[model samples]
Structure formats: C-alpha cells, structure tokens
Target: MRIIIAGAGDVGFHLAKLLAYEAHDINIIDMDDDRLQYISNHLDVHTTKGNSTSYRVLEEAQISKADLLIAVTESETTNISTSIIGKHLGAKKTIARVSNTEYIQRKDILDLKDIGIDEVISPESLAAKEIKRLLKESALTDTFDFEKGVLSLVGISIDEESELKDKTLVETAYLNPEYSFITVAILRGEETIIPHGDNKFMLNDHAYFICQPNGVERVLDLAGKQRESIKNLMILGGSKIGIQAARQLSKKYNIKLIEQDRDKCFELADTLPNTMIINGDGRDVELLKEEGIDDMDAFIAVTGNSETNMISSLVAKNHNVPKTISLVENMDYIHLSQNIGVDTMINKKLIAASFIFRYIRKGQVLNLTTIHGVDAEIVEFEVKEGSKILDAELRNLDFPQSALIGGVIRGGKGITARGNFMFEPKDRVVVLSKPECIRKVESYFK
Candidate 1:
C-alpha cells in the first residue's frame, strides 16, 4: 500500500512504524527535519521536509497516487485542511486528527465525510475512553470488549500469588477446562512473547487473554484477581483528557477533580455540576490527603507532565488505592508501568494511531486494537467465502504460529475456539498477531 502521513509527531511516528512492519511504501511529511531524520534512520520510510498544508509538498509526496493520507499534525486546522486537500488531490481516503469533540459529536450534521475527510479522531476522547475501560475492574491492567460483548481481551500482571505463576500453559490448561479462554501474548520486560504450550508464566509477566463474554471471570481467576466494583473516583489534571474523563465517568461514579489552575477549576465546576472541582496542586501529597485520597476507590493522574502523572499514581498506590491509572506520553515509559507499580499507563497517540491503522487496514477486518505497551494487535476478521482459513482444521491450516485465534462469533453467538475447530463462511474470528507476521495472518482470511 502507498501511504502518506502528514506529521512527525508521536501519532504519526507510531503509525509509520506500524506500517513499516507490513512493508508498505510509506511517505512522511513534516517541517521538523530532526524528527524526520530520526524516523528515517530507525524506520524504513521516506521523509520529506515541508508543510503538509502546502499543495506543493502534497504533490511532491505523490498524494495523487496514495492509497491513504493521514493528517495528524499538532494543529487541528492543518489536519483538516490537509485531509481535505489530499483527498481532492486524489488520495483514496483521508483521516484528520482533531482535538475538538464537537467535530466528532456533530460530524453527522457537519458531513465531514462529504467534505473529503473520511474520518476524524480525537486523542483526548480516545484517552478518556481508555481510562474508563481501565476502571472496569480494579485488577485488570487492560481490558476491551469486542463486538459489543461477544468477546473480550483482558491483560493482567502475574505476581507471586498467581496460581499459574512459574507454570507453563500445558500445566494451567486445567484452569480453563471449559475451553473458554486462551492466552494470546506475554509482555515480559521489554520483550513480547507469543506464548505456546511450553511457555511458562513467569513472575511479573503481563499476560493477555481473549475469551467469550461469559469467560471473563474465569480469566480473572486464572490471573489470581477477583472482580471489584469502583464507586468513587479522583481525577488529577485539568487537561482535555481529564475534563472529558470526568464528564464520561461522572455518570457512573462519584468524582472529585483537582486542577492547579483556579480558573480552570471554576470552569470545570460550571461544566461538571455533579463533580466536585478543587483548585489545588495534585502533586502535593498533603493536598491529596486533605482531599480524602485515602477514601478514594480509584485514582487517575492524567497531567500533561508524564513524570508528574507517574509520581501521583505512585503516591495513590502508597495510599492503598485499589486502582491507579496514569497517563504517560513518553513511549519509552510504557513498558515500565507494571514494573513501577502503576496499574495502567496510557499513551493517547498510540491509541489513536492504532485506531487509525485499523481504519486504513485492508480486507475483511471488522475491528483492530492494540494493548498498551504490548507489541501485538487483537484483530476481528470476517471469514470471506472460499478463504484459506475455512479449508481445514485450525491445527493443520499452517496458521502463523505467532498468531492465535481466540474466539469466533458464529450464528449470533460467541464460542471459544480450539485446534479441532473448523471455520465457516461469515464467521467473525478474533486473532492476536505480532507485528512480524501481521500481514501473513491477514493473507489467510483474504
């Protein structure tokens, strides 16, 4: 595929890196020569130094023959303009990264698609949704429901108390006697492992699973965690993510929002009537304690500063908060979340990049999502007629060993799939594939 990404920022860089794994012809445009140079040196992508909004730069990047154009610059105006102009210049599809929720909320009335932008993504909104998902269960490091509830992908950190700790998948197979769940990948330190029967569940390993909706409790049990309800919540930072998260989560939980800016706190009070807005420095341990931090069920730190967010979350952990979620913008710090005791460290750029990547993906892909800090993607694919996947039993299909089929939604019901299972046309299959073999796995469904 020929693709053009109009930014060298976090989202653009991550998207380009992901596309490089598929061996796509990628062209990146940005004015920052240093960022472009960094990406060019590490990734197999072409870089051009210029303004994405400039028609000359778009033409120079061969936008007319591009299969996809993604505008993700820091400026929302630039992103919208570039997407529209690129689409007019003959790019097959265009996506614009936006910061305003109104653009997405009112897209139906605005008809952005008719104006050439095929899709609009909001990092703040995406990050807010991620925070809400993480709060579903205090113990889960990460969780996402697929197809509205047919299947779920859950991640947990293995500790000394975990029954499966130090045991191989073969030994733990009895825990899932109903054949309802499967381990997809393990994130150990900086390495990502697509586990097999012999792969042992080591201490501190971040294990990921895919199971039917009915199997979530069992998956949690296997990870040595019990389900817990979250009733009280605290949000630090008055950034867009914090505000949006407060708005979304306030409907379900009692919320206390803290912002250092007095003016922002007043604005939040007016905007979120049900939420208690306090004007104070969230980083001040005394201030947090004064606000009843010890009584809170969950603590979320989403300040603009990654270091501050991590520190606040750690402080909350020290206070015995059951769930602590911190937002870390630095991609390098993602792997250190569990090791440092933060339940989940989120990167909005990565979440947006993954969503956009799914949008531009080829074939019968129904949905595609990536776990925070994990080097694999969980994709839902439709089995097309006459596809190679339906020709034989799963064990004999020679499916990429790095990819695992977790579950299948067939005949309006979801089932945990096994090696003896045979696929049928129109079945929606969920799979976890590492970057190295993503394209190879997609080929089987084509």
Candidate 2:
C-alpha cells in the first residue's frame, strides 16, 4: 500500500514506523528538516520537506497515486485542509487528526465525509475513553473487551501473594477447572514471552490472560487483587484529556481538577460544573496535600510535560492512592510505569495508531489493540470456511512461535483456547502476535 503522511510529529512518525514494518510504501511530508532527517535516518520511508497543504508539494509527493493520506499536523486546520486537498488530488482514503471533540460528536451533522475526509480521529477523546475503561476495572493494568464483552483480555501484575506467582502454567490448571481462561503472554522486564505450559510466573511479571466475561473475578483472584469501586479521583492538568475525562467520569466519581493557568481553570470550572476546578500548579506537593490527595481513590496525571505527569503520578503513589494513571506521550517511557510504581500509563499517539492499523489490516479483523509497553498485538479474527485453522486442534497446528491463539468466541459465548480446542468456521478467534509474526498470523483469516 502507498501511504502519504502529512506531518513528521510524534503521531505521524509513529504511524510511519508501524506501516514501514508492514513493508508499505510510505512517504512523509513536513516543513521541519530535522524531523524529516530523523525519519530518513531511522526508518525506510521517503521524506519530503515542504508545506503539506501545498498543491505543488502534494503533487511532488505523488499524492495522486497514493492509496491513503493521513494528516496529523499539530494544527487542526492544517490536518483538515491537507486531508480534503489530498482526497481531491486522488487519494483513495484520507484521515485527519483533530483535537476538537465537536468534530467527532457532530460529524454527521457537519457532513465531513461528504467533503472527502474518510475519517477523523481525536487522540484526546480516545485517551479519555481509555481512562474511563481502566477506571471501571481498577485491578487490571489494561483491559480490552471483544464482541460486546463476550471475551476479554486483561493485563495484571503478579504479586507475592498471588496464587499463581510461583506456579508454572501447567500447575495453574487447578485454579480454573472449567478452562475459562488462558495465560497468553508474559512481559518480563523488556522481553515479551509467548508462554507455554512450563513457563513459571515471577513476582512483578505482567501477565496477560484471555478469558470469558464471567471469569474476570477468577483472574483477579489469582493475581492477588480484589475489585474495588473508585469513588474519588484527582486529575492533574486541565488539558483536553483532563477535561474530557472529567466530563465522562464526573457523574460516577467525585472529581477534583487542578490546573496552573487561572484562565484555563476558570474555563474548566465553567465547562465542568460537577467537577471541582482549582487554579494551582499540579506539581505543588503542598497544594496536593491541601486538596486531600491521600483521600483520592485514583490519581490521573495528564499534564503537557511528560516528566510532570510521571512525577505527579509517583507522588500520588507515595500518598497511597489505590490507582495512579499517567499520560506519557513518549512511547519509550511506557515501560517505566510498571518498573516504577505507577499503575498504568497511556500514550494517545499509540492508541490512535493502533486504531488506524486495524482499519488498514485486511481480512476479518474485528478488533485490534496494542499492549502498552509490550511488543505485541491482540487481534480478533473471524474464521473463514476451509481455512487452514479449521483443519486441526490449536496445539497440533504449526503456528508461528511469535504468536499464540488466546481465546475464541462462538455462539455468543467465549472459551479459552486449549490444546484440544478445534477451530470451527465463523468462530471469532483472538490471537496475540509479536510484530514479526503479524503477516503469518493474518494468513489464516484470508
């Protein structure tokens, strides 16, 4: 596929990196020579230095022959204009990254698709929805539901007291006699392991399990955690993510939002009537103390500065907050969340990239989610008639070492994929695969 990306910023660069791995023909455009140079040096992509909205620049980049054009510049107007112009220039599909929630909320009323924009993505809104999901399942570091909660993939850190902490995968069968779940992947330090029966769980190892909706409590029990209801939340930063989270969660939880700018605080106060908005620096330890940080059940740091978010989340952890979620823009810093003390870390760019990738992938990929700080993806695929996967049991199949079948949803019910499990046509199979094995895994669905 030929893809032209406007902007060499974080979102654009990350998207280019992902597409490059798939061996797609990628062309990146930006005014900054340094960013373009960085992409040229680090990735196998064509870089053009110019204003992306310029017709001459689009023509120079050969946009007329492009299969897709993605506009993710910092400015919303630039993104919209670039997508509209690129679509008119013969691009088959166009996506624009936007910051305003109104664009997404009123997309039908505005008739944006009529003007040639195929899709519009808001990273802030995506991150806010992710925060809300995490809050609902506070015990798990990450949670993704498939087929309207028929199946779920959850990530949890093992503690010393966990039943499966020191036990091998085979030994844990007694914990789930009904075979309601399976341990699909393990993240130990920087390495990702597709586990087998003999693999032993170590303390602090982040384990991912695929299970049915009713099996969530069992998974939490084995992971040494109890489900707790969150009542109070303290959010740092009155940015787009913070404001959106406040708007989404204020009705269910008591929220106190802190912002450094007085004008922004006033704006938040006016917009979020149910939230308590304070005009103060989030990094002020004294101010946090006065705001009763210790009483907050959850602390979310989403400031513009990555370091500020990390530090504030750590401070909340120090104050014994049950959950601490930090918004780290840098993908490299995601690993620090688990290594340090933060409960969860979110990167909006990565979230948006994963969403777009699912849209691009061929076959019956119903959903796809990238694990935070891990080099793998959870893809839900629909089994087709006469596919190789339907020939034999999962353990007998010559599946790639970099991938494993996590679970299957059939007849409106979810079941953990076991050695004896046989694939049937029309079954929704969820597979967790490392980057190198994505193509190989996708072949079965074709």
Candidate 3:
C-alpha cells in the first residue's frame, strides 16, 4: 500500500515503521526538518518536509496516489484539517488524531466521516479506556479481552515465587490439566520468544497466554498471583488522560486525584464531582502517604512529565500498592515496564498507532491487537473456503516457527488450538506471530 503520513511525530513515525516493515510504500510529511530527518535516518520510508495542510506539500508527497493518509501532528486542528484536505486531494482513506474527547464522543454532530476523515482517534480517551480495563484484573500486569470476552490475553511477570518460573511448558502441563489456556509468547529482556513445550520460563520473564472465558483465573494461579479486587484508587496529574480516567473509573471506585496546579485542582474538582482533588506534588513521598497511599488499591501516574510519573509510581510500589500504572510518553521507556519495578507503563501514541494500523488492516483481518511492550501481534483471521489450512490438521501445516495458533472461535464457541485440531471454513483463527514471520503466517490463512 502507498501511504502518506501527515506528521513525523511519535504516532506517525510508529505507524510508518509498522507499515515499512511490511514493505509498503510510505511517505511522511512534517514541518520540522529534524523530525523528518530522524525518520528518514531510521526507517526506509520517504520523508517530505512541509506543512501537510498545504496543497502543494500534499502534492509533493504524491497524496493523489496514496492508499491512506494519517494526520497526527500533535495539533488537533492541524490533524483534522490535514485529513479533510488530504481526502479531497484523492487519498483513498484518511485518519485524524485528536486530543479532545468531544471530537470522539460527539462524532454524530461533527460528521467527521462525511467531511472526509474516514476514522478518528483520541489517544487520551484510548489510554483512559485501557486504564479501566487494566484495573479489572489488578493482579495481572496486562489484560486484554478479545472478541468481546470469549477470548482473553493476559500478561504476568514471572516472579521468584511463580510456579511456572523454572518448569518448562511440558513439565507444567499438570498445572493446567483442563487446558483452559495456552502459553502463547514470552518476552525476555530484549527478545520475543514464541513458546514451545520445551521452552522454560525464567524469573522476570513476562509471559503471555491466550485463554478461554474462565481461564484468566487459572492463568493467575499458574503465575502464583492472588486475585484482588480494586476499590480505592489514586491518580496523579490533572492532565487530559488523568482526568478522563478519573471520570470513567470514579463510578465504581473511590478516586482521589492530585494536581500540582491549584487552579487546575479546583477545576478538576468541579468537573469530577465524585473524585477528590488535591493540590499537591505527586513526587512528594510524604504527600502520597498523607493522602492514604497504603490503603489505595491502585496508583496511576499520568503526569505530563514521564519522569514524574515513573518516580511517583515507584514510590507507590515502595508503599506496597497492589498495582502501579504510569503513563510514559517516551517510546523507549515502555520496555522498562517491570525492569524498573513499575507494573505497567503506557504510551498513548503507541497505542493510537497500533489502533490505526489495525483499522487499516481490517480488510484482511477479522481482528488484530498489538500487546503493549511486546514485539508480537495477535491476529484473528477468518478461514476461507478452499484454503490449504482446512485440508489438514494444525500439526501438519508446517506453520512458521515464530508463530503459534493460540485459539480458534468456531460456531461462536472459543476453543483452544490443539495439535490435532483441524480448522473449518469460516472459523475465526487466532494466531500469535512475531513481526519477522507475520507475513508468512498470514499466507496460510489467505
């Protein structure tokens, strides 16, 4: 696909890198020469330095022949205008990134689709939704529901006390006699491992599993983690992401928000009637304890500064808080999730890029999800008639070594993919694949 990106910022660069890996023709446009130069130095995509809203610049980037145009230039107005104009310039599809929740929530009144933006995404809103989902299963490092709750992918760090720490998958078979879930992937320090029966999970390894509806708890047990229900919550910062999370999660949990700006605190108090707003520094350890950090079920740090968020979360962890989630703006900080002792580190731009990438691939995929901080993707493919996959059992398919069929949803029922299982036409097959071999994995489904 020939794609044109309207920004060379984090989100646009990430989307370009993902598309570039697939050997797509990608051209990035931005006003900053340094950003475009950095993108050109690292990625194989072409870069054009200019305002994307300008028709001449769009023409220079060859937008008329572009399959997709993405606008994520940090300015909401610029993104919307660029997408609209890009669509008029003959781009097949356009996606706009926005910071205002109003654009996403009031889409019907805005008519963004009619104006030529085929899709719109708000990173702040998406991050808030992710925080709510992560809190549902507070014990796990990450929890993602697929196909509405029929399938789940859970990640947990292997600790010193984890039952599966030293045992290989074959030896740990007794731990899951019912086969409710399958070990899909493992994230060691810098490598993403596609697990086999002989793969042994080491301490500190982040293990991922694909489970049935009731398999989440089983996976929790296998990891030696006790389930805990979240009630009291604490959030740092009054930024859009922090405020949005408090607004959404306040209905079920007691919320206390801290903001360094006193005026912002008062505004937050007025905006969120249910949440308590405090004017204090989140980096102050004494303030955190005074505000009852020990009793808090979860600590969320979404401060504007990534350093403050990480340090505040570390302080909460030192206080024995059950869960600590930090909003990391730097893409490089995501890999330090557990290594730095924080439970979860999220980058909204990374999440937004992955979401848009999935939407772009909707034609070839039933569903696709990129696990945060993991170098693999879980993709759902609908098996078509006359596909080679339907002719033989899974074990005989000679599947890519870097990929694994995690589960299959057949006739609306979720089933764990076993070695002897044969796929049927129209079945939704879920596969976990590394980037290096994802294209080969997609071939079998095609």
Candidate 4:
C-alpha cells in the first residue's frame, strides 16, 4: 500500500514504523527538518520536509497516488486541511487527527467524512476511553474489546499468590476443565511467549488471554483477582487526558477531579457537570485524603509530570484504593507500570498508532492487537482455499516457532486447536507472534 503520513511526531513516526515493517510504500511530510531527517534515518520511507497542507508539498510527496493519507500534524486545523486536500488530490482514504473533543463527540453534527476525511481520531479522547475501561474493569491491567465486546482480550498480571503461577499451560487448562478462554500471550520480563502446552506461567508475569463475555471473571479468578465494581474514582490533574476521562466516566462513576490551576478547575467544572472539580495541587497527599481518596474505588493520575503521576498513584494504592491507573507518555515506563504496582499505564500516541494500524490491515486481517510492552501481536486471519495453510493439518505444517495458533473461530464458536487440528477453508485462525515474524505468518494465509 502507498501511504502518505503528514506528521513526524511520535504518533506519525510510530505509524510509519509499523507500516514500513509490512513493506508498504510510505511517504512522510513534516515542517521540522530535524524530525524529517530523524525519520528518514530511522525508517525505510521517503521524507518530504514542508507544510503538508500546501499543494506543492503534497505534490512533492506524490499524494495523488497514495492509497491512504493520514494527517496527524500537531495542529488540528492543519490535519483537517491536509486530509481534505489529500482526498481531493486523489488519496483513496483519508484520516485526520483533531484536538477538539467536540468534533469527535458530536460527529453527527460536523460529519468529517462528508468533507473527505474517512476517519477522525483524537489521541486524548482515545486515551481517556482506555483509562475509563481500565477503571471500570479494575481487574485486568489492559483490555481490548473485539466485535463490540462479544470477544475480549484481557491482560492480567499474575501475583505471587495467584493459583496458576508456576503451572504449565496444559495443567492450568486441565484444572479449570471448562476451557472457557484461550491463553494467547504471556509477558515475562521483556519476552512475550505464545504459550505451548509446556509453557509455565511464573509469578509477576503479565498474561493476556482471549475469551467470551462470561470468561473474563473466570480468567481473573485464576489470577487471584475478584471483580470489584467501581463506584467512586478520584482523578488527579486537569490535563486534556485527565479532563476527557473525568468527563466521560463521571456519568457512570462518582468522580472528583483536582487541578492546580484555578482557571483550569473552573473550566473543568463548567465542562463536567457530574464531576466535582477542586483547585488544588494533586501532589499533596493530605489533599487526596481530604478528597476521600481512601474511600475511592479507583484512582487515576494523568498529570503532566511522570514522577508526580507515579507517586500520586502509589499514594492512592497505599491508601487502599482497589485500582490505580496512571498515564505514562514515555515508552520506557510501560514495562515498569505493571511491575511497580500501578494497575495500568496508558500512552495516547501508542493507542492511536494501534487503532490506525488495525484500520490499514482491515481487509486481510480479521483483527489485530499489540500488547503494551510485549514485542508481539495477536492477529486473526481468515483462511482461504487458495491459501497455503489449507493444504494440510497443523501437524504437517512447518509453522514458525515465534508464532502460535492461539485458537480458531469457526461457525461462531471458539476452539483451542492442537497440531492435529486441520485447517479447513474459511476458518478464522488467531495467531500470536512477535512483530518480526508477522510477514512469515501472513504469507501462509495470503
């Protein structure tokens, strides 16, 4: 696919990296010469340093031949203008990143799609939704809903007291007996294991599994966690992400939001009717206690400073809050988020990148998700009669060791298959593999 990206920031760079791995013809446009040079040096993509909204720059990037154009520049106006021009200039599909939450929430009013933008994504809003989901569930470290929550992939961190710790995959399944969910990926340190029968889960490892609606609780139970309904949530910071999450979750959960700036607090109060906005420093532990942090079911920290967020989240945990979620913009902090006792750490840039990547792979991929901090992807592929995978049973195939067939979705049912399970035509096979092996695995299905 020939794709043109109009941004050289974190989200754009990440998207380029992901698409370049799939051997897509990519062209990136940005005004920053340093950023353009950085992207050019790092990625195997053509770079044009200029304003993407300008016709001459778009022409230089050859936007007319682009299969997809993603406008994710820092400015919302620039993104919208770039997408609109790119679509008019002949890009097949166009996506824009808008900063205003109103445009995304009131999509029926603005109708960006009518103006040539196929999709609009707000990283702040996307990250907010993720935080809301994490707080509501309060059991799993991460959750990805597929097919409108019919099928969910959840990640749970196994504690020292977990019942399934030190047990092999086959043994755990045998003990459970019902076989409700499929264990897809295990994150141990820096390694992600697509579990085999012999694969044993260790303490402090974060494991992800795919299951139906009723299986989420069962999976949590296996990891020694019980579902706790979140009633009250205390949020620190009045940043965009903080305000967005509080506004969305306030309708369902009792919310108390704190901001150091008096003006931002007033703005939040006006924006969020159901939420209580306080003008105070969120780093003050005394203020948190006074605001009833101890009685809160969940505490979310999304302040500008990472250290402040981490420390406040720790304080909330120390105050006996059942769940704590913090936002970490730094990619390096993702691994430590789970290990250091914070329930979940979210990055808006990464979430936006994942969402866009899934859209780009829509036709060939039934579904695709990347686990945070895990160097692997869980991709679902539909088997065709002409595909190499349909030639024989799984036992006869020389499948890559890095990839594992997690399950097969056939006839509206999920089945965990062994090496002897035959791959019939139209079977939707779910595979878990490192990013490096995705090409090898996709070739079999293609």
Candidate 5:
C-alpha cells in the first residue's frame, strides 16, 4: 500500500515500522528535521521535512496517490486537519489520532467521517480499555477475545508450581482431554516459540493459549494460577489513561487515584466523583502506604515517566498486590514486565499501531492482535469454500513451521484445533504466526 504518515513521533514512527516490514510504500511527513532524519536513518521510508497540513508538503509526499494517510502528530488539531486535507487530496482512507475523549464519545455529533476522516483513534482511551480488561482477568498477563466471548487468547507465566512446567505439549494433552484449549506460543527470555509436540514448558516461560469461553479457568489451573476477582483498584497518575480508567471502573471497583500535580488532582476529583483523588507523588513509597496500597486488589501506574510507572508497580507488587499494571511508553521496557514480576505492561503507541495494522491485513482475517512484548500475532481467518485448508486434516497440510492454528470456531462453537482436526468451510480459524511466516499462513485461507 502507498501510505503517507503525518508526524514522526512515537505513534507514527511505530506504525511506519510495522508497515515497512510488509514492504509498504511509506512516506512520513514532519515539521522537525531531526525527527524526520531519525525515521529516514532507521526505517526504509521517504521522509519529508515539512508541516503535513500544508498542501504543498502533502503533494510532495504524493498523497494524491496514497492508499492510506495516517495523522498521528502530537497536536490533535494538526492530526485532524491533516487527515481531512489528505482525504480531500485523494487519499482513499484517512485515520486521525486524537487525544480528546469527547471527539471519540461524541462522534455522532462531530461526524468527522462525513468530512473525509475515515477513523479516529484515541491512544489513552485504548490504553484505559486495555487496563480494564486486564483487571477483569487479573491472573493472566494478556487476554484478547475473538468473536465476542466465544473464544479467547490468554497469556500466563509458568512458575515452579505449574503442572505443565516440565511437560511437553503432547504430555500435557491429558490435562485438557476434552480439547477445550491449546497452547499456541511460548515466550522464553526474548525468544518467541511456536510450540510443537516436543516443546516442553519451562519456568518463567510466558505461555499463550487459545481456548473456549469456559476454558479460561482450566488454563489458569494448568499454569498454577487461581482466578482472582478484583474489587479495589489504585491508579497512580491523573493522565488521560489513568483518569479514563478510573471513570470507567469506579462503579465496579473502589478506585483511588493519586496525582503529583495538585491542580490535576482537584480536576480529577471534580470529574471523577466516585474515585478518591489524592494529591501526592506516586513514587513516594510512604505516601502509597498511607493511601492503603496493600488493600488494593490491583495497582495501575500510568504516570508519564516510564521509570516512575515501573518503580511504583514494583512497589505495589512488593506489597503483595495481586495485580499490578504499568504503562510504559518506552517499548524497550515492555519485555522486562514479566521478567521483573509485573503482572502486565502496556504501551499506548504499540496498542494504537496494532489496532491500525488490523485494517491493513489481507485474506479472510476477521481479527488481528499483537501481544504486548511478544514478536508474534494472533490472527483470526475464515475458512473459505473450496479452500485447500478444508480438504484435509491439519496434520496433512503444509503449514508453516513458525505458525500454529490455535483454535477454530465452527457453527458458533469454539474448538481447540488438534492434529486430527479438519477445517470446515466458513469456520473461523485463529492462528498464531510469527512476522516472517504470516504471509505463508495467510496463503492457505486465500
């Protein structure tokens, strides 16, 4: 795809990096020469050192012939205006990254789509929604639902107590004889492994499983984790993500929010009537104790500083908080979350990029998502009529070694894909694939 991206900031840079892997014709525009230079030096993309809102700059980037134009500049106004102008300049689709929650919640009133913007993404809102989902399933490191709640992909770490820790994939088959769930991928240290029959689970390995709705608890038990219900949440940072999470989860859980800035704390108190807003430093261990960190079922740190978020989450974990989620903007730090013992780590840029990449995928893919720090993707594809996938059992197919068919949803029933299982036409197949093997995996559905 011939894609033009406005801004060379984190979101735009990350999106460009993802699309560049697919060999897309990417053109990035930015006002800062240094940012543009960084992108050009690191990525195989055309960089234009100019404001994206300028028609002359857009023309220079060949926006008229672009398949998609993404506006993710820091300024919300700039992003919106660039998307609108790019759409008018003949881009087929335009996406604007917005910060204002009102622009997303009140979309019907604003109707930016009618004016040419095709989509509006709010990173903060997306992060908050992710936080809410993580809290709901406190035991799992990651969770993603496919086809509503029919099937889900969950990640859990293997510890010394895990029954499957030293067992190979085939040896653990007896644990779930009903075929309710399947382990798709394993993250050991920094390596992402698409598991096979001989692959044995090890300590500290992050195992990802695809299972039916009722199989969640079974998977948790196999990983030596018990399902915990979270009713008390303490959020550090009054940023958009923290405030949004508090607003959404206040009714369901007891929420206490701490903000370093006194003015922001008062603003949060005004907006979030149900949440207790405290004016104190989240990094202060004494203040956290005084505010009852130990009593919190889940502690979430969404502070702007990555170090602060990480340190505070560690403190919560030290205090025996069952669930600790930290928002780390630096993508490099995400891989350390599981290694350092944090429950979950989130990056708004990565979340937003993955959400947008779903629209770029080809074939019959119904849904697609990338794990927090893992180098693989969970993609759902529909088995089409007369496709080769439906002709034989999974074991007989020439499937990619770097990918695995985790589960299949047939006739609205979720089934864990086994070696003897045969695909049916119209069945939804969820496959976990590495970046290098995604194209090979997608070819079968095509």
Candidate 6:
C-alpha cells in the first residue's frame, strides 16, 4: 500500500517502521530535517522534509495517490489540519492523532470524521485504559478480551507453585482431558516462543494462553495465581493520562492522585472532584507511605519521566502494593519491567501505532491490540464471503503454526471453535499471532 505518514515523532516513526518491515511503500514527512534524515537512513522509507500542512508538501509526497495518510505530529492542530487536507487531497483514508479528550468523548457534537478525518486516535487515553484493565485483573500481566467478555488472551508469569511449572506441554495436555484452554506463547529470558508439545514451562517464565470467558479463574488455578480485587488506587502523575485514568476508574475504586507541580495538583483538584489530589514528588517513598501506599490495592506511576515512573512503581511494589503499573515512554524498558516485578508497563506510542497499523491492513479486521512488552498481536477479523478462511475447518486450513484462532463471535454469541468447526460469513474471529505471522494470517481473511 502507498502510505504517507506526517510527523517523524515516536508514533509516526514506529508506524513507519512496522509498515516498512511489511514491504509497504511508506513516505514520512516532518519539519525536522534531522529526524527525517535519521528515519530515511535507518528505515526503508521515503522521507520528505517540509511542513506536512502545506499543499505543496502533500503533493510532493504523492498524497493524491496514497492509500493511507496518518497525521501524528505532537501538535493536535497540525494533525487535525493535515488529516482534513490529506483526505481532500485524495488519500483513501486519513487518521489524526489527537490529545483532546473532548474530541473522542464528544464525537457526536464535533465529528472529526465528518470533516474528512476517518479516525482520531488518543495515545494517552489508550494507555490509561490499559492501566485500568491491568488493575482490574491484577494477577495477570496482560489480558485481552474478544467479543466483549466471551474469550480472552491472558498472560501470566509462571510462579514456583504453578502445577504446570516444570511440565512439558505434552504432559499437561494428557493431564487435563478437558482442554479448557490453549497455551499460545511463552516468554523466557529474552526470547518469545510459540510453544509446541515438547516445550517445558519454567518458573518465572511469562506464559500467554487463549481461553473462553470464566476460564480466567481456571487458568489462574492451574497457574497457581491467586486473584486480587483492586479497591484503592494511587496515581502518581497528574498529566492528561493520570487525570483521565482517575476519572474513568475513580467511580469504582478509591483514587488518590499525586502531582509534583503545585499548579498541576490544583488543576486536577478542580477538574476531578472525586479524586484526592496532593502535591508531592512521586519518587519520595516517605510521601507515598504517608498517603497510605501500603494499604492501597494498586499503584500506577505515569509521570513524564520513564525512569521516575519505573523507580516509583518498583518502590510501590516493594511497599507491598498488590498491583503496580508504570507508563514507560521508551519501549525498550517494557520487557525489563515485567522481569523486575511491575505488573504492566504501557507505551502509548505503540498503542497508537498498532491502532493505525490495523487500519492499513486489508480484510475485515474489527480490532487489533498489542500486548505490553510482548511481540505478539491480538487481531479480530470478520469472516466474509469469498474469503479463504471459510473453505475448510480451522485445523485443516493452512494456518500459520505460530498463530491460533482464539475465539469467534457469531450472532452476538462467543464460540471456542474446535477442529471440526467451520466458519460462516460475518463471524468475528480473533487470532493471536507473533509480529512475523501477521501478514500471513491476514491473507487468510483476504
């Protein structure tokens, strides 16, 4: 596909990298000549150094023939203007990255899509929602639900007490005749393995499994993980993400927000009436303790500084907080965070990039999400007539060995498919696959 991405920031750059690896015709535009040069030198993409808002720059990037135009500059105004202008310039689809929470919540009042923007993505809000999900399921490192709550792809660190620990996949398969769930992937020290029969699960290894709804308790039971309910949450940042998270989850859980800046603390106090806003450094352990950190059910650190966020989250975990989540800007720290004990480390840029990547891919992909620190994706695609997926039963199809069909939604009901089950048109199927197998898996739905 011919794609033009405006802004060489983290989101745009990451999107370009993902698409370029798939052999797409990618063109990146940015005002910073240095960033454009950096991307051009490292990635196999055409870089255009100029203002993306200019008609001349869009024309120069061949936007008229572009299949997708993505505006992800830091400035919301620039992204909005670029998407609107790019759509008018003949881009097949346009997406704009926005920071304004209002644009997303009040979409009916001010429809950005009506003005030519096909989609509006909010990274901060996405990160916040991820943190909320992590808190709700504190035992699991990651959880992705498909077809509402019918099926889920859940990740858990293998504890020493787990029954499956030190057991090979073949042994476990015989031990449980019910076959309640499917073991999809395993993350060892630094490598992610698409497990087979001979693979033995080790202690401290991160394991991802696909199971039907209400299988969470069973999965946790087999993994020897005790479920914990989140009651009290302490938010360490008063940024947009912090405030938005507090706003969304405060209704169900007791929320306490701490901001280092006095002005930001007051702003949060005025904006969020239910949350308790305090002026204190998140790095200060004494301050956290004074605010009943030990008594809290969950602690979330989402400050701008990645290092501070990581350290503060570690401190909260050390303080015996049941769950700890950190917002890390640098995607590199995500893997390490899991090993060190943080429940989940979220990256907004990656979330937005994956959101846009799903749009560029052909087929009836209803939704797509990447697990934190994991190199795999949870893709939801609809079965349509003339699609190759409907020709035979799932097990008989030439499906990628590294990927598995997790669940299917038919007529608003969720079904865990067996080998003999055949897909019907309009059935929503969820597949879990590694990054390398995404294209191959997408081809089935095409």
Best by TM-score: 3
Question: For model 5, which pairs clash?
Answer: none
lDDT by residue (tens digit), candidate 4, 60-88:
89988999999988899999999999999
User: Candidate 4 — worst ten consecutive residues by lDDT sum?
Assistant: 144-153
Each prediction's RMSD over C-alphas, in Å, is: 1.9, 1.9, 1.7, 2.6, 2.0, 2.7
> Candidate 5: what lDDT?
0.88
Q: Which tens-of-lDDT digit does each residue in 1-446 have in candidate 1?
A: 89999999999998998889989999999999899999989899999999998999999999999999999999999999999999999999999999999999986689799999998999999999989888988988888887777788888889888988999999999888887788899999989998999999999888998878768888787777888789999999989999999999998999999999998888888999989999999989999999999999899999999989999999999999989999999878888876788888899999899888877774448888888888888888999998899889989999998888888999878888888999999999999998778889989888
Give lDDT tens digits, candidate 3, residues 180-265: 89999998876789999999999889899999987888988778889988999999999999999999998999999999998888
Residue pairs with backbone overlap in model 3? none
Off by over 4 Å in 1: none
Candidate 3 versus truth, CA RMSD in Å, comes to: 1.7
Between candidates 4 and 5, name the one with more favorable lDDT: 5
Preferred candidate (TM-score higher): 3 or 6: 3
How many Å off is the CA of 296 in candidate 3? 1.1
lDDT, candidate 5, 1-446, per-residue tens: 89998988888888898788777899999999888889989999999889899999999999999999999898999999999899999999999999998878997788888999998999999999989888768888889888787899999989898999899998998999778888899988778888999999998888999989878889998877888889989999999999899989998999999998988777888899999999999899999999999898899999999889999999999999989999998767877776888778899988988878886674447888888878888888988888878778899998999899989888888888778988888899999988767777877987
Judged by whole-model lDDT over C-alpha atoms, candidate 3 comes out at 0.89
Candidate 2 per-residue lDDT, tens place, 295-323, comes to 99999999998889999999998998888
lDDT of each: 0.90, 0.89, 0.89, 0.85, 0.88, 0.86
- Assess every candidate by TM-score: 0.95, 0.94, 0.96, 0.90, 0.94, 0.90
Candidate 2 accuracy as lDDT: 0.89
| TM-score of model 6 (CA atoms) | 0.90
In model 5, the runs with Cα more than 4 Å from the true position are 31-44, 361-364
Collision pairs in model 6: none
Cα-lDDT of candidate 4: 0.85
How close to the true structure is residue 176 of candidate 3, measured as C-alpha lDDT? 85
